[model samples]
Target: MALNEDLQLQALRLLQADPARSQRDLAKALGISVGRTNYCLRALLDRGWIKIQNFRNSRNKRAYLYLLTPQGIDAKARIAARFLQRKEAEYAALQAEIARLRAEVKADAET
Candidate 1:
């Protein structure tokens, strides 16, 4: 997956997990710049996948919460399924390669 796609997926998961998380905090968790985080958020919002709500916290009254819309949840599911499928394929390939290597080593040792 590309950076934008990965960023979107991580942002969706984190926002779904914790709506009240700050953008700066999300950026830290995502290892991306705040500007990039904002860009992702804007894209999600534009797609109507996520919504922002105002919440008053002890320290910040203007804190904005990122909540996933129903559409966002559905999208997240699809993304997760695709990611799992790709990983499974990669794992199978790795296993096959390992087996091949082990057999080659055994044959060499026998000779």
Candidate 2:
């Protein structure tokens, strides 16, 4: 996945886990700047994947709740599946490299 897609996936997962998290908190968790977080959020919003609602009774009047739409839920699932597949492929490659190195080391020891 591209960097933006990766960030979006992380953001969506984080929001699903805790929709009440602020953008600053999200940025911290994502290890990104708040401006980038805001950009990702705007993209999600434009895609109709999430909706922002203000919490009227909250102490922070500017606080918002980010809720995922049904489409967003489905999108997250698909993205997760793809991410898992990519990780699995990487794992397989690493395992192959490890096995090759071990065999090479054993052959060298015999000589």
**lDDT (0 to 1) per candidate:** 0.88, 0.91
Candidate 2 ranges beyond 4 A from true positions: 1-3
Q: Which numbered prediction scores highest in TM-score against the true structure? A: 2
Q: Tens digit of lDDT per residue, candidate 1, span 51-99? A: 9988865467778989999999998888888888988999999999999
lDDT of 1 at 54: 85
* lDDT of model 1, residue 110: 100
Over 4 Å off in model 1, which ranges? 1-3, 56-59
Q: What tens digits encode model 2's per-residue C-alpha lDDT throughout 51-97? A: 99999899999999999999999988888888889999999999999
Lowest summed lDDT over 10 consecutive residues: which window, candidate 1?
1-10
lDDT of 2: 0.91
User: What local lDDT score does residue 99 receive in model 1, on the 0 to 100 scale?
Assistant: 100
Best by lDDT: 2
